[model samples]
Target: EGIFELEYLDLEIGRCRILEPVKVKMVVAKTKEGFTVGGFVKTALEHPCTRCLKPVRLEINGVVEALYLPKNLASFKREKRLETLKNVIYYTGNIVDLSERIIEAIVVEIPQKVLCKPDCKGLCPYCGIDLNEHPDHVCDKISQESDIDPRFSVLMNLKKNEEEG
Candidate 1:
């Protein structure tokens, strides 16, 4: 059982920036086949909110687990090898570098839909106004356009036919 601490400065994960030095805790253990490496990383990031495009600060925590393959394994079919060892990582020499796996783990923690808050109102498509800033704001198109959806246009003429008859 071994422990290691890795710290990074100003690391960029996708479009977000790490605000401070982030530390990742690595735990390595010897296994029958090879070695197992597992770790957890925590950091604070600043990026534009997906909804309103406002700068928002978020805390991200990521966990990584990988199985290091031994160098003396027999060669097999590429497809069979990939299927059998989907999560296994192969190392050429004595040392195994986990930096790429750590970065991948952290990046996977990023949410697909990022918002300033849980119920953040997005910007207005017509006027380009932040709905969060003006909750009561209304666009002129709301009054001019019909409330009926375009998909329901066929049903609209039924009401007119009944009124005329």
Candidate 2:
């Protein structure tokens, strides 16, 4: 059993970044073949909202569970790598680093559509201002009444020629 503090900068998870040191508590149980580790990691992440583009702070609490196999045992059988443990993570030395596995667990849990709130007003296409901030925001109205579909261009030209003739 052990506690470790991981402080890293510029660690990017998707488009998010860890703003501080991550706390991890782990317990290792020795097995005949290898060792199994179970723990939890806690940290904070900053990411831009997918809709509003506003910076959103997210609290990450992820459970970490991984199996470590020695180099010889890991390399002896290639099939065992996948068949033995579905979530087995390989390590070389006596020290098993669960950082990579922990990171993977957290990243996978992040949702594809990360919005700041359930109802987020996105930015305006013309002025690029946040619509949420200015509910009454309006842009120059460009009329598309005279615009003709390109697919009907030939018919439009023939009608124009007939009217002019």
TM-scores for all candidates: the values are 0.66, 0.69
What is the Å distance of residue 7 in model 1 from its true position? 11
In candidate 2, where is summed lDDT lowest over 10 consecutive residues? 2-11
lDDT (Cα, tens digit) per residue for candidate 2, span 1-165: 343454432334345667766767777899777888888877777878887888787787778877777777666656644586678766676676676777866676566777889898888776688989997987553223246567877987897799999
lDDT of 1 by residue, 93-132 (tens): 8888887876777677877777899999989877879999
lDDT of 1 at 137: 90
Top candidate when judged by lDDT against the true structure: 1
Candidate 1 has a TM-score of 0.66
- In candidate 1 the C-alpha lDDT for residue 124 amounts to 89
The residue ranges of model 1 lying beyond 4 angstroms of the native Cα positions read 1-14, 71-74, 77-86, 140-165
